[model samples]
Target: MGDTAVGPTDLGPGRRQPLDPLDCGGLELDGALDLLAAGELTVTGRMTDASNATLYCEIAAGESSGRCVYKPIRGERALWDFPDGTLAARELAAYEVSAALGLGIVPPTIMRDGPFGPGMVQLWIDTDVTVDLVALTRSDDPQLRRIALFDAVINNADRKGGHLLPAPSGRVHGIDHGVTFHAEGKLRTLLWTWRGRRLSAEETALLRGLAEQLTGDLGRRLEPLLTVTELTALDARLDDLLDTGRFPLPSGDWPPIPWPPF
Candidate 1:
């Protein structure tokens, strides 16, 4: 991660989540990001639920002890298709794209060199564990639907139920976006409840706005993280969603659902 990236700088606490970035002791999102970027990372635990290398770490920036997940680039296992030491970059890119789409779904994340090597550090979200995600995925909840559409736009290959964390304020936040924005049709998700359903006009407008941003600012932001082919494919995905105007069917290349669904 040579890019020296900052995260969620201007974001104020607009969402109703339990812990908003800007709500912590009146600190700005930029302050939290600076902590994640330059603070001393103390690895506390291992997040074994994820398929890749993930660690639960506490970042100490002065008096603040911020909890975050640290995914080091050196810990990333090699993939036959994707390049090496790139998953952490992709995770930061996902946060940027989500911010560009005007969604506060992805938690604050930044790219920095940690104890393990160059990696990503993202704020730990406190979730409502009592909510039945299986039930949520089976319903017509607009929250899940929006996330589903967002997954399609990014060509996310993994949307496991564990990744869909519901906040205390009823908003569902998506995390672990390492395997996303692929050039090929590699979408494999468990969110198929609204299959073939037409999107609301409001949602359509959001998509249109996202498409516009892709051609300009979002494209520039993702250039360092993703390849040119991936960007072109992302553009094609926006066009495809606009043309179809409905929930997409799963690509037959792989199974629609991820293993160990929850």
Candidate 2:
């Protein structure tokens, strides 16, 4: 089976259960006072406007320590137009999938049932750590190039330079994956600038492995997080990119890079 066909179970652990948003209060969410910075008090003070009614909170914790970030689901808002709350769910799912694939991703600190509804709590990342594409494309780092290629293969629509945060240890972590793997097509930010470039033996091998597993039993296993339609679309997108035998380029009018690293 192609990597796209491979089910979640095929990768490793079965699908992770959705986190209960309510369980986070005072514990993983509101708790952990010592881990926070001096100015930080509680989640109530940090709430910021996210898309729609959904709110995003920054825990005001220092960079080195794990900081709590909360995402609350709101209703009937176009900016937050996720009627099904699938976007939040999808973000969680992507983190889980990337973890299973051995990619370095920021894992959720906690998931709990909220007063509004199901919500998520995750580690706050440094807004300054993100590298702009203009800077990245100008660099001589082969590792960065490889990382960019990996982002392409994964259909990371929002792989803006700002999204790639370099930790104190120098490892890069991608964030804000709420809009990934839509049933329609790959639509979002553009990062594929190396299309048609020759793939190294290692790259070829990885793609081949991923393709074989993506659409088979593995796809079915991801059903809990992704609909069959979404999974099928994901597999098709990967297949198209692999067949092109080229690096991806900016797709549409969307800016090739993301702005405001924060």
Candidate 3:
């Protein structure tokens, strides 16, 4: 395994119930969200390469079970820029915005209490290991383009190549969204291939819908996770996108892309 590494199996005797095998198949989005929100989470392994502690866990509620990544708030290291211990909430916020846009670019994620206390639990996406990530980053994949639009909205500060998970069913999902939703203009990513391109009619329509949702339902949902200032900045970004009717060009204030692109 390279950047997108999976930990070794820790399943053995008396481990509650064996979870569904690592693959692209899983429950529907609603069911997956329920499973993650109510399941009895058992930490099975960890992704050592992650900046913060990322536990690969088995979540079981009755006969329903699945695999997910659990990032504990306590495990989050303080960042000079991001507020302390808010990474888990930010990750959940990213999922909410993705869902609101109807992009489904992020796997189902929820904020819940795990074995290690409160954390963000997301359905683990099994990616197609054969896909070359570097090549995929440079390609003009529509899925990646959708993600680029979503990233711009969230102010995602770290969208590396490794974050792109290409499923076997041809759907691309992005992960590791803890460092997103910053109030500043920190939209570093590898999906800049679509930078400055005119937004498709469909994309523009989706943004318009999202703008309305933000002021109504979506804003209420995100209020608890993000600050007032942050939410205001999000609205401003949306306005800029719709006003310009084009993808955003990189701001010289921050690095255009995250270091170690992969």
Candidate 4:
């Protein structure tokens, strides 16, 4: 295993940055609602196997009071993707980055006290609302290409069709970003079939802006969420992709999809 130590510097500002208890902005948890016992709340649910962290359902106590998913950040689990164990801080960091990039992702609502330990409460995405992107991409939709481009910029390792959840309101969302930004190669997923395709003038412009900001305040802010080695790896990956003027290609073997769509 790699260094799994949680240090002060391992917290950053992007969606992939680590979340510390100090950052919890006074969001108090009332009580845990047993969705299983109380069928009163109409919640369409399914188990997500891709997540190493166990998830459960509860009644949303905020403005949108309905069914919500609760994920507690705990110690290392045996079946985790990283042998050293999983960190809730890292998962929260990814969400923060996604939120900053204006990507459609399930943002975690930090709660102070709950049945489980320090965890995140987020809006529950309906299973029926999600569409299999692999099936949808069989047709020619330019938007799919745009999404792919964004995925590339973020260095997302698990951009499978199943990860794209389409809401009834005509919006799409991505989830499960635990394996991103490692010291080793950024391995996993299959979102790069459009290599060498000329990015639109607008897309090219966006990349330029993002790259410039990444090395400045953005990079400095994200320094806390990852290790020195991991952060160095991230900078190297970004430099290679942006400088080479080539769309990133899948580095290795076949069956490049992440399993158990959540």
TM per prediction: 0.88, 0.64, 0.91, 0.66
Where does candidate 3 have its weakest 10-residue lDDT segment?
1-10
lDDT (Cα, tens digit) per residue for candidate 4, span 1-262: 1111122222234333222212122222212112211222322443556445546554533343444554555623553344343444455445544444544453343322234454444545554335556666454455566566655554556666666655544545555555566655554555455766666666666566556656775566556556777667666765665676666666665244555322
The order of the candidates by TM-score, greatest first, is 3, 1, 4, 2
Q: After superposition, how far is residue 35 of candidate 1 from its true place, in Å?
A: 2.7
Give the whole-model CA lDDT for all candidates, comma-separated: 0.77, 0.50, 0.82, 0.48
* Candidate order (lDDT): 3, 1, 2, 4
Report the Cα lDDT for residue 16, model 4: 39
Q: Clash number for model 1?
A: 0
Error of 3 at 69 (Å): 0.2
Candidate 2 steric clashes: 36
- Against the true structure, candidate 1 reaches a TM-score of 0.88
lDDT, candidate 3, 129-245, per-residue tens: 899998999999998999999999999999999999888777888899999989889999989999999999999998998898888867877898899999999999999999999
lDDT of 2 by residue, 36-128 (tens): 322232344444344434344544345423345555544323433233665555665566555434444533433344434444445554443
After TM-score superposition, the amount by which residue 127's alpha carbon in candidate 1 deviates from its true location, in angstroms, is 1.6
Model 4 C-alpha RMSD to native: 8.6
**What C-alpha lDDT does candidate 2 achieve relative to the native structure?**
0.50
Give the runs in model 1 whose Cα sits over 4 Å from its true position: 1-28
